[model samples]
Target: MGQQYLFWFAQVHDDFRIPELQSVAEIHGFDLHIPQDLDASRPFCILELDHEEHARLLARRCILIRSVCEFYARGSTYEELHERVRQQRPRWSCYIEDTSFKFIVTAYNHTIPQARQREVVESFSYMDFLGKIDMKSPEIIMTCFEEYPDKHGTTRPKDEGDGEFKEVFFGRLIEEGSARPLVKKFDVKKRLYYGNTSMEAEISLLMANQTLAAPGKLIYDPFIGTGSMAYTTAHFGALVFGSDIDGRQMRGKDKQPGIIRAASQYGVAHCIIDLCTFDVTRNPWRCGELFDAIITDPPYGVRAGAKRLGRKSRQDKEQPPTSPQNIAFRRPDDQPYIPPTKPYELSSLASDLVLLARYMLKPQGRLVFFLPTVTDEYEELDVQSMLCDGMEIVANSLQNFGSWGRRLITIRKATTEHFAPPSFEQLDNVAHIPAHKDFREKYFQGFKKSDVEQISELSDQG
Candidate 1:
């Protein structure tokens, strides 16, 4: 039989755990089995992969997963779990032979005591091993986990809390999850440049995983801020490119210290192809080239309002005194023409982003991006709604923040059909992005009239 492995997911952001698994597996060439009814919110689940090496590869890139192991036993109760562990003693002994090992217990969704932990370890004393115990650095880590669900909506375990066990699992450590190291390496705290909407490193890496990023692949982000997606994509060896309507996000014409600093810090400075000052509504890419992935967190008009290139509807009737600070540099016979920015509707921005992906992505290449929504009013967006002639939905993962959260949606170009841009009406009917159309107004409506000044600062939050 093919080997069975267990992946331990952090209780936080459980929604992303499985989708990240599917993505990492697809990118690495492993046809992993995805359980249809699996509760990804739980601490652990068994993955039926073709080989042990496949499990190792998954652990290397997975951010939501805490660790991966050779699954030994799983059960609904302590009695059943111990019985299964006892049955595996013959094979277990062989695995432990000539190997220094350590035992660990993890009680998920609940707190465990040291005395109780020792009692559990003593229960497994019947097994035999030839090597000495090594706690600091063991070749093998045999683990037992007890999981419990909260008594109610509150995950906070009270001082007198004693939650009932929901499940039990046992496994041998294959590898620890890569999320920790990757997070430390690209943390936004250390980034030289960032926006109020500047992305966190863990989420950026998770998005990259969902995009199925890999070395030598081409990825682009249209709303690149502080190069979150850019550097994270480069970290995975992808050639990254990005554009934004806001020149301020780039800082200056020749200097993008934040972007350059981050890329340099991660040693992926060479992967950044270029950063263009272009509007998504009016895509500037004319080359026949296509990208392997298009990943972004588009402006929701919540923090930073969406904008586009345009001109005033009416010309100024008067010319005022021009100081050196406001003087226009031009030839004597030439008239300087300046372009102003107009409000770009959020619904239109969403439509444009998807259309851009459809036109520029290679067949089988993935388009991953986030869409905002209310927690209680979230209408799950299906890939069917955004389907073009050859596009298919690959994955959808959601994360909530108070009453608001964003969904990470990925769709793939399944065939070689040329992109045929959909009409505004046609695209609007596909998903619930209408909420974004008035996002800024509705978002600010929550505050009092006195808080208008704070809106500027609020828009700057990451």
Candidate 2:
């Protein structure tokens, strides 16, 4: 039987932690049972692994998981917890007698006082010791977790401590999670290039994690804004390639060096295969079924405007230069004409991405992308229809802050043997933009639209 372990998950991005962990676990062929429909808010969870290497692999891939530990004891009360630990005292003495170690306590929904924490640490000092103590760097790290009496993690004095804890756990730490430092390594504030809608490094890596990013895999990003997705995938050793609709975005518009700096900045330049200014709707990729994954954050026309190639407007026309300097600065006629872009609706963007992934992705390959829309708009569009063709939804994780939230949908291409795609009608639903609901109204749901119009009218009159 595999050894048992306790996983202390970080309390953030609650909705995404499970899907991300499960996705990675599936890739490694490690079957982990987390029966409690747990969220990040609940920090304590148990993981049963067949081997210690398997536990380390899980920790290496997870940013949400703070750390994994060697399972020691678990119980409903501190007394039970200590009693269970007592059972292992004979065995633990051998592991700890001559080892340098540190005991850290983490209390969920409650804070363990320093005095109480000291007591907990000292309680374990009964074990025979020969090695010198080293708190800065220990060969062995020990941990104790105190789960509160209720979901809120409240505590009571020893006089009335019967139900003070729902669960208590003690374990030997395996290794600290690799993700916390990665978060700091890829922090947006330190990025050489970023945008109004640039995906945060943490979430960017989450998208990469959902796909199980690995060395030699091909990852494509349809809408590579500041290349957060690209950088993350490349960082994982995947050969990353992507494009932006506007060449200006990649070539540098106003001192923004586009996505190239991200590679150089991150020192993962070799992993970046190619980044171009190509329309996703058009099949620019000649490498059929060559990509192993596709990760992107398609523009939602909210923070950044979503656009596609289309006919030029009335103001777009070539005119004779009025001066010698004007002619000198004029775009060379030999230069290829770059088409103008029109508004690209959110629904249409989803359709093109899925269709592109069908041919672009090898069967069983993954696609992870974001979809942010108003609840009303989302229902009207029927998000299921988005994956009706050529793919199946592996996981759908939502991170909703308020009225508007984004869903990260991970998909795998359905092979011919198991290819049961949605009918043409369902695929057609992707292009169908529901009735022109008040886009502005729903976006600013916090404020009334009528008042916005009233203020606009007043400003115009003034």
Best by lDDT: 1
TM-score of 2: 0.80
**lDDT of candidate 2 over 220-329, digit per residue (tens):** 88788778888888887889887888766665654535577767889987788887887776535555677899898888756676777653354345533245565456
What is the Å distance of residue 419 in model 1 from its true position?
3.0
> Cα-based RMSD of the predictions, in order?
5.8, 5.9
Q: How many pairs of residues collide in model 1?
A: 3
Taking the candidates one at a time, how many backbone clashes does each contain? 3, 0
Off by over 4 Å in 2: 27-29, 34-41, 87-93, 124-134, 148-166, 253-257, 311-336, 375-381, 416-441, 444-462
Query: What value of lDDT does candidate 2 attain over all alpha carbons?
Result: 0.73
Question: What do the candidate models score in CA lDDT, each in turn?
Answer: 0.75, 0.73
| lDDT (10s digit) by residue, model 1, range 1-462 | 687788888767788888888888898877888878887877789878888888888888888778988888988877788889888776577755688988998787676777777888877776766688899998889988887776556646353344257888998998988665888887888876666788888899899888888888999888886688888888888999888887568653346456876688789888998888777666667752379999998877777877777533343235343444454554243754444576766656666667667788887888898877555544544334445566677877778776566778788878787865433332435444444445566565652334655775687883
